[model samples]
Target: MEKERRWTEKYRHLLQAFYFAFTNGYARGYTNGMIFTGKSKYLCVPGLNCYSCPGAIGACPIGSLQAILGSNTYRISLYVSGMLALFGVFFGRLVCGFLCPFGLVQDLLYKIPFPIKKKNLPAHNQLKYLRYVILAVFVILLTSLIHDVTGTGIPWFCEWICPSGTLLAGVPLMILNPEFREAIGFQFFWKMGILLVIMLGSVAYYRPFCKYLCPLGAIYGVFNPVSTYRLVIDKEKCVNCGSCQKACLMDIRTNQTPNSPDCIRCLKCVSACPTGAIDSSWNIARSKFESRLLSEEENSPNPEVTKTTLLAILTIIAGLATMVSTFKYNLDGVLVYHFSGLTSGRGVLAYMLVTLFKGIVSFFMIITGYKLFINRNDENAVHRFREQTRMILKFVIIIVIAGIASLFADLSLLSVMFNAILICPFPIIGLPLLASAASSTDKLVQGKGSAVLWWIVFVLLAVVTSYIAYISTVIILAG
Candidate 1:
């Protein structure tokens, strides 16, 4: 355990966590040994992880992008793309640096003891835009072409290019499940081979896939110039030591301009700065607040107000529980059975209510997303709302469309209600999980009992659902 605390070891732990998420979360089959349904069921990992991985806790943004792009609606992937652009604007490649597990893997690989050469690699930067091209071609153009020809929508990337999918979901599950092993074909081998090559190269180059091909990175990079948390160089104070340039993994020379779309906000340059001139900050308020707190000797111990400590604790518990539950179902042989209930068409009302609730949730999602777009200089709520709601009419169409789709799906009352409650936690899970590795709580570790209560609620719900399925199956068998 003591050996694990080394920085390299700690970073490797992050890689292990990343590996665990991909393999155990997305790739592994359940205890029931079901096949992955190819639905965009898992959440996007914000980096390069593919959506088809059964073990994923949340949806893959790229998969969502493709689905929305090639949806039955045939509308452009405005919401998914908008979300990506919004994240980019707020954090830029900061998502890749701090949030992406795949990037963490690459970082771990780069730490190996060997002679390393650093170069500008702007040629590679140009290729970063290729993800946008892939989004357009595979997601939109090819999806449209294939569907038009065959009346079936296919995710070409999941079938072909996504190495994260193979690394995290494919190999582990195939090894564990005999059924999965039998199902593996030439295509699976092809994907594994491609992923192997990428893995080998990743040991040498730093995130070749990210630099040359991740659409999510391209989308986020758009937000780099304007993101609140960014690298700030005092042009007046830069001594041209060029150390900052050498320190950057993204090959961005911070002394020249830290505003490059390629900048990952890894803080290597900030830490390496000799003049103490570089200052990396999240927001004006946070930076100012931290500066004041650091200046004061007493505030150093417990910096910042304890305003959202409860919220943070609740969030952590919810996220951790959800991750564990999702992983269990995907990996540990959980069975999903369809049940018929006494309530039927009346279920439509339940679905309607759920749909309404989902719409409201999307409203908050948009509000939170757009709030990031507002200039930090602006303080008035009026301006914030105005800037956020400029495209309200378009989003009205989106909400109505989503509502209409919900209304039409053939689902049960209990299922619909369950879906609504399930949907609510997603945004809550998303914002915080993407922000930090662990929970954002006080870390003083109080009120753990309340968090346990939340877990109990979830487990009870799962158990009840399982019991219903088992009973229904037994009755059918007896008959």
Candidate 2:
């Protein structure tokens, strides 16, 4: 029982590592050495999994980000960046300590009886700054700049550095894939050498790459002091025996500064402090009194008011998400990317205008959606509805124009059919707008006939557009 209770979050670190590895285990991809390009590719994992690892089910955020930042299509760039920030806010460098597969590999390597001269590296302080430089120049600046003839820049870190790519993706793929082996060059060997050196160094030192090379670590480290979940020192309980610092692999003075950026949040310091002065917790910087006050304030809201507030919040959030995905994924960006063959400067300008119009419509949506759901504006409801309908339709005309523009991108029957779908990013937005324009959105949602009418209108528009586009393309080709 004592052994089981020795560590407060026992086996959690190992469990997280195992969990991520299992999730990334696409066993068939190893046999084929092909990336799993499913819908999960859009869901970037928090840890630094390789972009092209055969077994990876999700895309690496950093690698995918380089492509997105370099290309004209940044449909999911903001979304991925937001995910990275969300992770940093909650866990900071705890990702490095446990979640990253590469980090786990390095940790296992360290146990091979190759201890360094000291726990930390020589000139560790100065060497640590190298990661920030790599993060800025190699990861961000080069990926955004330094383009080739294809109008996309080199992902410099992935091309020249990044041992994770080398070890996880490069080595396995070369062994498994004949076609991939044909493309091998000096660059592959160079990356392999770096990976070997880092592996050996992990045995000699503690995570040399994380300390001096990993841009992701640099990015997450910046959030350590500010992240919602982090370490704290209870000064009242502190005997200042310096046990925490002695146990720190990163050599952080945990008693003096518990939330240091260099700290990987391993929780070893918490275990080392015999006084139990060290702690791993949420909102760690806040006082007990402050937390209690926040708790009280949160509970003070009546249940009905809390429920309504939650509903309003959720409605606005849904409306905003709908607006972004509608513009970014369905209607505008797809046509802009696939149909760029025919779409020139004027088309690009039109797209920009359409995107701008989306923001206004989104604002109107959240306002009207919030008001409609709460049964507000019962006074002169008809006039308000008429005004919202006019405003919304006017903006939607630009969207219709965007869909129509897709037909010009290509004259193929497939293109025509896709244009119909783009034009109708509808049915998704349709029912909501239909309800929002009514005196009572709630009642409209309840009305089965109203929903049926909306679907009919949607179908009619798609069929009519498809016929017109196909006929026009046929006539033009004949001419």
Candidate 3:
């Protein structure tokens, strides 16, 4: 019963992690609104995953690593490596705990109501080096075959390999969109089979990929030694009964040191420690909360709003914004086409209005997103929001990159502006808007029309941004 209380919320954090991994809003600003039919946005997140998955918001690290290697011009991807460093310094293996959607998926898979127990499978601890080997092989293959000499290698991991991208984004989308299904070939089947194997393996192990083959884990582990937050073992309170080691799914010997990069911070052993010797703190500082809490709800915010609901709401807002924006921009595109051969300025003005409207919508999105973070009392919400914001910034960056590319491809100022606006929603302003609305609604119960008006504006902004983005894509492609 005690163990259940301590670890009940452990799964919740994992749930939020999954949400961030799959959901676009969490990864917003991460991918920069650049879909990967490919031009030259080489370099993705430096992890084991692939980017071609539809759910990915930011560039996949492994994909980006391969691209950097493949490109002769940029010898190394300083940006991606640096981002990983920054992430590790602050978060450590906590990334596995809070940000990885794949990790969350594995956790969910493990909880299938089937009887499962932690297995102590011992092998060469050196087996942990396999991800680096994979990284090295990818780099060698990609860099060695650089197409500039013959100009050919695109380093096709996402298309030819990558189970996460295959399972989460590729197969499902292909099923839903016939064009994608038709695009499938032998490679798709091969990848799907591999994904099936990994899915089954994950059911038996705590996290097979994370434990064995995740290059991102290896990189982040390097920084865990000095990261701001880490696990600390209080030797003074030591009974050293080996209960922690017994409980640790990672097989960590937590008595001596608890900062192993391999440790997932799942807090299982923390709960298992009979002497209360194990603790988590930032920079060796003392912690406010202990390993065991009497009530699980004490750690959560608005227990009423589950992590899934937060994820759903975020997705709804982002999708709505994109959809609404797409519709409005398409309407404007039709009007502009009608006026194109006649008076050019009218069409230009109309285009500009569409662009402006998208910008407004983006502002609302960014504002709303940020506001949610500000008021996020739940630890899971805070964790998810931070990653979401980071990814949002990245998303904006890629959109800016894409916008520049559009310029070279003869894309219009209005179109570029529209894309830029649609891509960069003002999540920072979201908190104030929500707060004001809440306060206003509470004070003026009958005058709810005003609150509704605010919501309508918010919704309209999203629509306009999506429309502008959709129309811009059409115009760019058509031209």
Candidate 4:
């Protein structure tokens, strides 16, 4: 009996892996080559696979939906909506469970051997509703409204929040094209930050993004209750032993309810049922009952050393390294400064602002990395670090605003002082503040008043430094 159960589990994994490879088989131009531009792309896949993926042969439904909604013609396609509905009714979240490449990634991440085990946090249940909100807002309303107003609508979710898009398409495309890397700006950084957060969150939680943010998952979840392919419990056979519920990675109480929206139809519960009670049904076709019942002992969660954590850690490290490398390599030859002349002092100020903007983005990247890899489990520590990071960003913004105002005042001294001050604190003070925020005991600032006081001191220092630099420049001109 034990051996048979093991074989079943092995077969399931093999089948899932096979599907993953088959779905993404067009690996010809995967490494920065042109995406598949064939007619197959006109058809939408039932999962979150990005059309822009070089290996992807089919388009992502959510991406296609947004494109149609945001088109200049503002045309809504019944075919797209109808196809999605048909898949939802037929398979429910079976696609997410068995087909989605991104879903496979999350499952594999959870299987990583990490010593720090965490249960669902408070408010986790409430957070599940967020995916629905994302579907309604970013995927639908925002896409339609923005296109109507601007005549050029952005795929808000894909552009700003889709980690699957970032992983499958954005990163690969960027690596393939040097021109794309050079063209990256604030938008790229913002998306990477989101991807980093989602990746890290997946490490600690099972399918965190699907639970809270995936609009595609949200859509298919709505059809779970009524889908033809469903998990049904034999009420007479179920002894209410709770084994099925314990084995459910989705946190679903299978003893009470079998057809939950949260269920990915993973069949982990079906395999765990000791009474041979739980079964999968497809339009009157039910799985056969086994003569032997598996032991409950086999349901224990395994915690072994796996490559998933190492992979996640490496990804975060690579992202940070890439950002630093890009900044360093492009500093002197940043194209923005070349295209726009800095002959006037105002132009120089604008250039400085652009530099500062990049610095702010770096700050976000660093903070997100720290949160994902370092202070992930400690909620209080994460909150404190966010607050401190925001304080530093606010200081940078204030300094830039002060520099712009100084330009209008004709105070060349103030301008020099602002530049000097901006150059000073980030390394000397801001980095330390970030480090302290991650610490167990140290507080960067005691309170809001202390934070405000430090900002004022920095502003004063800028004023004084500008005055000195201004006087020196005038002296040099006279000499």
Full-model lDDT for every candidate: 0.57, 0.69, 0.58, 0.67
Better of 1 and 3 by TM-score: 1
TM-score of each: 0.54, 0.59, 0.53, 0.57
In candidate 3, which residue ranges exceed 4 Å CA deviation? 1-11, 14-23, 26-50, 113-126, 139-153, 156-161, 283-479
Q: Which predicted model would earn the best lDDT?
A: 2
Cα lDDT of model 3 by residue, 1-479, tens digit: 44553764466664665556554343433333223443333434433444655445457665676666566667566877777788788878877766676777777776665565444235738766675665555544655464655554566555454677776677657755667777788888898887887677677767776776666777787777688867778789888799988887777887766888787667778788887777666523532333332244466654424432443355346535554554555445546665664335544444445444444445545564556545555445544544454554454454555445545544455554455354434332443333344334333223566547456546645654565567568768968
Worst 10 residues of 4 by lDDT: 302-311
Please provide, for model 4 over 52-84, each residue's C-alpha lDDT reduced to its tens digit, 9 standing for 90 to 100. 887888889999999988888756758789989
Error of 1 at 17 (Å): 3.8
Measured with C-alpha atoms, the lDDT of residue 274 in candidate 2 is 83
Clashes of each: 21, 0, 43, 3
Please give the ranking of all candidate structures by TM-score, highest first, separated by commas.
2, 4, 1, 3
How much is the lDDT of residue 53 in candidate 1?
48
Candidate 1, 1-479: lDDT as tens digits: 12222343236446546554653363334443444554445434456655444555556677777776666676477767776766776778877776776677666676575575443235775676787887567756776556645455677776687777787668766766788899888999899898877666667677776776666676777788787767777777789999887877777789888877677667677766777567765534676896775576354443222312322333333334433333333222112221333345445444444445445445544444344334222334323333333443344344445445645654333444444445344433333322231222233223565445435444544543464455457547857
* Candidate 1, position 34, lDDT: 44
User: By descending lDDT, how would the candidates be arranged?
Assistant: 2, 4, 3, 1
